[model samples]
Target: MFALISLSDLENDFINPYDLTQRLNRFVALEYATQVVLVAVLLLGGKWFLAGLQAAMLVYLLHSWHVKQHTVDATDVFRQLPVQKKRRLIMFGSFLLFFVIITYRFIESIIHGLLTEEGRAHAKKLFQDAAASVHGY
Candidate 1:
């Protein structure tokens, strides 16, 4: 959520809403809002603890992006290129592929590292402490 908010703010004047990053951000936000609404309505609707936060988020998402009209251009020139030309977009600097793959591998390694036995034990201990604090233990 911070990432979405930050990118949207940073790219406030982004020329194309149809841009892949923007589209992905929107899709991710939509999925999140959907999950929040579903969880709030189905699970926490009657709870007094966190229901208000959940409901407020639903209201916020609905009031903000839902009511706004964000249109993607159907006649975008970028979309009119031949399939082969489109495939060669980053070919001028083949390093782009290497960068993407390396970045993906680095992130994957970090994710895997966080799931290692020691990492999981530490995370579980932290979560248990959080739960205890929340419950006033």
Candidate 2:
């Protein structure tokens, strides 16, 4: 029984598609990180403002959509499989979803930062500079 179990474990490692899927799954987290940093740059009481935030969000959403669609396309191939296979699919899907959610919350933190009194005070100078540039005065 021990030998049989050991063989099974080896077989799993050798045959599991997760080895490939995990490599691809890494890209999902990478996308989330990229989006978070861009959001921070746009909203973290620095140089950018609402316009930059919007642009960053748009770009991130587009990239996320593309990756999600690709995942869906790949998932369709296994749609007819059994529960066990479906469970594995769900696990990977949730991993990507969780990272994306975490990234969004990070962006929300930046929004909170901007809404605070101190952050608003910082924004005032930025707005004044924008006004001066716009009016060329």
Q: Point to the candidate with the largest lDDT.
A: 2
Model 1 poorest 10 in a row by lDDT: 83-92
How well does candidate 1 score on lDDT at residue 99? 52
Q: Taking the tens digit of each residue's C-alpha lDDT, what string does model 1 give over 1-137?
A: 33333334434544453453454345546645664765466454464434554455455445544644122232442343332132224222333544575588679987897789998888789899999999884
Query: Over the stretch 1-137, how does candidate 2's per-residue lDDT look in tens digits?
Result: 22223224434665344443444445655655665665676566554544364454556456546755323222332332243244345444544665686588789988998999999888898899999899875
| 70 Cα displacement, candidate 2 (Å) | 21
lDDT of 1: 0.49
Winning candidate number (TM-score):
1
Q: Count the backbone clashes (under 3 Å) in each candidate.
A: 0, 0
